[model samples]
Structure formats: structure tokens, C-alpha cells
Target chain A: MEKPQFDLQQAISRSIQDLYEQGTITNSDRHELQAHLEDSAEGLITTGLSEEEAFLIAQKRLGRPELLNEEYAKVNHNLRTDKTWALLLAGFAAISTFIALISYSGSIYYYLLERFGLSNYTWPVVAFLCLQSTLFLFIALKKREVSNFLRDQVEMNPLRSIVFSFTLLALVKGMQIAVLRYLPKSFSYPASTIYGFQGDKLIEFATYVSLFCLFVSLLSIFFSLRSPTKGTWRAAFEKPSIAFLMLFGIGTACFAASTRSLSGLLPVPMHFTLFGLVYLMGAALISYYNENSKLHLFFFGIFGFCAELGVGVVADIDRAQRGIGQIYTPFFILSLIVGLMAGWYMGNMLRGKDAIPSR
Target chain B: MKEISKELMASSLAPIILLILRRQESYGYEIIQEIERLSGKKLAVAEGTLYPILKKMEAKEWIAATWKTGSTGKERRYYALTQKGHIELDSQYEQWNFLHDLINTLWKSPNLTYNRL
Candidate 1:
């Protein structure tokens, strides 16, 4: 007797897959049905029927596809509206950009520039932030819907998502630089005085500008966290520990550079060394906690700043008594200790009751 | 054999499925075969139609499904009635018996008369 090879299962699988692709049934239900269809086909094959005949009989017995799909839809809710919130996001971006372009040429730009003593360059920065705040307000109003849309509607490949995020960050940074470069001659007082043109008014002006930049950066990061694609933003930063470390490192480097330029103390090399040390500490903390919560990052930033202010007051006193040249050693050591303690505490609090194992 | 009315069959489907599962745990294919065998070919449940009923019952927590290897060395999904399902089956049985008795009594009633004129 010649035996027949069956392609019945393949045909059954293809039909089931068609239903799956059409969103008529979910993966689990499809598998169940496929198995049932195969079993029925096999049972008929065992009764001396050819593979083709058995497959046809099995499929016919399964009944109509439309009826099956209707029933599956009731249970699975497989079909859903294909609306993307990206459209809303894109519209906001386009409108904001158009408004900024118009404002750059119109009276509003000149009004802001004259009223705040802002140059043509700096006024755009303010305008840009205003536009960003409008978008943030929109996001806040529709956060839940936006979040759902992001999860369900947005199908992004990893590479595309990464490229989009990096481009967004670079664009923001470029705008900041453009604003900084276009400042008027009066805005140059901070840099000149910090490098020893030596006027109290110049120092105050520089301090105010620096303070404004610091505030803007903090606000930028805070708003980025609230974005619907926060996961992508978080991933770009690597881990929370590194983000905290990098922020602290950059802040320290800036402080060190400005102070070095101000008082001619502790040359450029030492500032680099200090940054290197903070970065290493950040890398070490990465080994401790691979993941960080937003709350943990928030507390770490707050505590790091508080520690700096506390230590800075003491360092200032020491500088008055012992001279600026002698203050770097103790100040650097104290800040490092304070940052480490804060980092450790925040990481522990997030993990909840799993304190560092006692030696 | 007369084909069962879709309306009557639809109404009776859940109770019939529950009764089959009551005897033993079974998968979709097995349950369908058992129904056909028990009815002596009078009742035929379309394979596509049974899944929706199973899904509904599972959602209501009247049944639970598990995957196990069948005799052919392939995995098959089996379904068994839950405690709630058993209670429901008992209730359905009582309701069906009452309806059956009522219909029988009405058919045999002395007052039941029809004028051909």
C-alpha cells in the first residue's frame, strides 16, 4: 500500500494565520483553533482518506470564516481605532515653529528684545521656551490619552526612535548656543569680568545669566520627564545613576572652571580630574542599581544641590581665612563625600528596605 | 432526523456544553465530537461557533483552560468546568427539566382542542 504525505496542516495553519493578520482573533485563540483543525484533519486521514480530502472535510466542518471572526471579535476586541497621537504632537510642533518664525520678524520679537534688554538672539530663546511650555500644557491636558496612544498606536523601531530623540536634544542645545552667541556687547560683561576685568557689577551680571541658564536646563529636564515617550528619553540617558552623576559632574566642572578663571586657582587639569572622579563614581553606582525611578533621580538631584550649598558655605569661610589657593583640596573631598552619600541614600530608598548589606 | 432550530439550539448550547464538561474535562475538538455522538447526529455544533461560547464561559470564570500534550505528541488546550460552572450546570438542568415537563403537560391537557372548521 502506498502512503500519502499530508499538507493539510499547512493549509489549516495558513487560514488561521489569515484570521490572525486580519485581527479577527488573538494569538492564543488562533493556536487553539489551529490545533483543533489539525486534529480533525488527522482523524479523517486515519480513516483511509487522502490528505486533500481530509483537509477539505476538516475546513468545511470548521464553518464560515466571517461568522468565526465575528464571534472572535466579541471576545478579543481585536479590532481597534487606528488613531495616532503623533498627529497632535506634530501639529503642535509645526504651529510653534511657524509662530516663532513670524515672531522673529514681527513687533513681538522687538518688543521682547527691548523690554527685557534681550538681543535679537536671546529673545528667540525666550520665545522658544514659551512655545515649549504651550506644548507641555497640551500634553498635561491629554496625558492619559497620549500615554495610551503611545503604547498602542505608535509602532517605532528602536533605531528610528533613538535617532528622533537624539535629533530633538541636539536641536534644543543648538538653539541655546545660538542665543548665547547673539547676545549684545552689554551681555559680554559676565565673561569679561569673570576673566578678571574686575567689576562688582560685572560679577553680578555674570552670576544672573549663569543662574538663568541653570534654571532653564533644570526646567528642560523636568519637562522632558513628563513627555509621553519618557521611556525613550530615560533610555537615552542610560540609567538614572549616570544622569545624576553627569549633571553633577557638569555642574562641578562649570563651577571649577569659572572659579579657576575668577581667582586663577587650581588650573584646568584639576577640574578635568574632578570631573573624571565624579564620572567614575557614577559608573560604580551603575553596578549597584541597573534601574532608577524618577523619584530617586529627583531626590538625588535635590540632595546633591543641598550638599553643595552646605559645603560651599564652609568652603567660602575657609577661603576667607586661609586664602582661595588652599581651599580646593578640602572642598573637593567634602563635595565628593556628600555626593556619594546622597547617591547611596537615594538608591537605597528606591529599592525599599534593602539597605546595603552590612559587612 | 429534523434539524434543530437555531434559536432553540442557541438557547440550549451552554447547558449542553456544561453537561459534557461535567462528565469529564475536554478540549474543543473532543467536546464537539462528544456532542455529535451523544445527539445521534441530531445536533451539529459548528466548530467556529463553539469558541465564542467557550471564551464567554472562561471570561465569566465558569471554566478554566490549560495546555497539555495529547496522545499524538502535540499540545492540546483542555478546558474544565470550575466550581461556579458546576453550580451553573445544576441550575440549567433544573430549568430545562421544568420547561420540558410544562411542555409535556400542555400537550397532554384535556382542555387542549383545535377546531379544523
Candidate 2:
């Protein structure tokens, strides 16, 4: 027969652990409570009680784990408002929202657009177009105020800043989708046609031209509106244009070199153009928001991850619809490396003595 | 003797705990044990309820806490009375005494008489 012995310490520990598992008390609180409970158990044991009896009495005297946790949480209410919990809650909310959106897409979409007079595509198009107009206006009319605002107010925690920039891009993408899907007739732009060889060549040319034009126009606007300062032409190295050019050049070269292995997996030039545009925008946003080098690296890593995830999700959805399967692609690793180099070059440029470091 | 009512127990907890800390710095477990020893097990104070009250006092700067190794070789959070806490305990003691005296005076009378309003 087994001896009538019990692990009193383990019993107390397990009970206290239940509180932390329930998310009522934090780890520190759990540690403190455990020590206190151990002390209580020790006292009870010394008072001529058996280990099992002492453990039982001590546990009872401490009251229910749930109640104790509630009391502790009430005391540490401010500590309970940690950002990690907020992030977790936000993730849950996003998942639930996606489920709802997918489940009731037709009804929700119709109600939002028809009854509310806010067609997703039309509204996003008008809103973003207005935003673009306002941005250009601010650059042209109130250049100093706009520039000053960007310089002064853009500083934030690096992780938070990257999340904000990513969210902003996501919003822009949503608007773009709205315009394409719902208000395509509003614009007489030629529809994208993916054909065999010649059509792919046409797309490649168009993408390249669009990317170049977009970069040049944005850089010209930014430089023109920025406050006038005394510096040599070399000072231009600190500007976002230099970083964008470096990223574009390096990214394009890597894509060109890997074209043989990647051609079967993707339309190489098209993806290259898109990656260049996205990386340029992401780098500028990071520099504009934060002057931290490590954050630039982090931003690039996250950007690469988002790019890969976006491509995978799109491919999966297309495959599901067309009954086709996807081939394995390791091209994202190349994108990741390009993103890191881009961020590194950008960080060095911004931090270099040639440019006036705002942060 | 009857068990102390929760309302009365709650009203007296701060003053009792503060007075205990004023005498000597004490951790939660030791403090609870001291109270039990003083009350001869008649007044049962739940350890769970003690922590929130202690935290509230700490938040108010009436008590400050420090962690120290106990006799059992485990870290224990010991709380001591602040100057503000000392003053608060004195005032609460006065209130408790006054209430005690009034209750005693009322109970001492064999028969109580009241006029109808």
C-alpha cells in the first residue's frame, strides 16, 4: 500500500498557478502570492498540523483563487491595461470581424453602399483622391506648416510607427480595391489583361514607367516643399529619394538575377515593379516617422513578411477559385534581403552628417 | 461570542492593519496571523480580503512596502506605516474609541427608553 503522504508545497503552487492561468493576476503577482501562501503553509504546519491538513487549511484560508485574483486585479487596475493585452484583444477583434465580413459580404456590402450612399469603391476613390489633392495643396500652399508637422509630430515608438504605416497602406489598398471593383466604370483606364508573352512585356514596360514616374513626382514634390536650408548638393544624399533609388536598383538587380528560377513561379518583372514601389513607400514612411536604424530594419522585415503573406493569400484564393495548385516559391527570401539592404542604406544616409538629422 | 459583521469588520480593517504596521513592519501572512492570534480566532479575517485593503492603503501613501527574506527563506513583502499613515491610524483609533464608548454606554443600560417622533 502507498503511504498517506501528500506534496503540500506542490498543492499550494498548483492552486496559485490557477489564478495566473485564468489571466486574473500577472506573473509577478503570482510569485508574490506563492511566497505568501508558502509562508502560511509553513506556519500552519508548525502549529501541530499534518502537511496535508496544513495545506488544506492554508488553501481554504487564502480563499478561492478567483476571488483573490479579482482583489489583486482591482488593486493593480492600472497595470492591467498593458499594451500586450490590448494587442491580443485587437487580434481577436480582427479575426471576428473578418469572419463576419466573409460570412455576410453580400448583405453587408449592399447595405453599406446602397442604403448608406457610401459605395465602397466610390467613397474610397473620392476620399483618397481628395486626400491626394489636399496633400498636394498642403505641399504647394502651406509647405512650411506641412513640413514642420511631418518633422515634429512623426516621432513615435518604432514598432507602433511601423504598425501605423502598415495600417495606413492597408487602408490605401482597401480604397484602391473599392475603386477597382465598384467604380471601375467611373475611370476609362484600360483593364489589366494578363496574356502570354507580348502582353506580359507590355505590363512590364507599363509597370516600370509607372514606378519611375511615381518615384520622381513624389521626390520632386517633397524636395520642393521642404524648408530651404544652406547645404551642398551632397546634402541630397539624406533625402528619401536616395534610399528609394538604392532599394529600387538593388531590388531590381536581385530580381533580374533570380529571373530564371522565379519565372515559373511569378510574373517576375511585374512583381519586381510592385516590390520596388512598396519598398520605396515603406522606407520613406519609416524615415518620416522614426530616425531609428534598428526600427528601419524591423520595418523592412515586417514589410517583406507582409509582401509574402499578401502574395500567398492572393495565390491561394485564386487557386481555390480556378482549381489549380501553387508551386513552391522561395523568392520572398530575396525580397527580405533587398528590404534589409534598403533599410540599412536608408538609415546610413539619414544618419550621415550630410543630412540634418531631425530626430 | 457572535461573529463580527462584515460591515463592522471592513470598517475596522484599515485601523487594525495600520496599527499593527505602526507597531512593527509586517507582511500579509504574518499580519493575518498576528490578527488571528490577538483575536483568539474569534474574528476571522480572510487573507484574500487583506491584500486589496493593503494595496489601497499603499496607493494612498498610507503604507509603503518592501520585500525581504523571511525566517523561512522565502521572500516576503513587508509593509510599514508612512507618516501620513500614522496620522490616519491615530484618527481612526479616535473614531473607533468613540464608537466603542457610545456602544458600551448604550448596552450598559438595562432598559432603553425612546420618545415617539
lDDT of every model, 2 decimals: 0.59, 0.58
Highest lDDT: give the candidate number: 1
Give the worst 10-residue stretch by lDDT in candidate 2 chain A. Answer: A188-197
lDDT per residue, candidate 2, A142-240, as tens digits? 433443333222222324534554565556446555645653332212322221222233233333433344344444335532322211123343333
The alpha-carbon deviation from the true structure for residue B13 of candidate 1, after best TM-score superposition, in angstroms, is 1.0
The digit string of per-residue lDDT tens for model 2 on B1-117 reads: 348888888888999999899899998888888998898877788887798888899989999988888876778888999999998988999988998987886788747664411
Model 1's TM-score against the true structure = 0.42
TM-score of chain A of each: 0.28, 0.28
Query: Which stretches of model 1 miss by more than 4 angstroms?
Result: A1-6, A78-359, B113-117
Best by TM-score: 2
Residue B40: error of model 1 in Å? 2.0
lDDT (tens digit, per residue) of candidate 1 on B15-63: 9899899888999999999988988877788887898889899999889
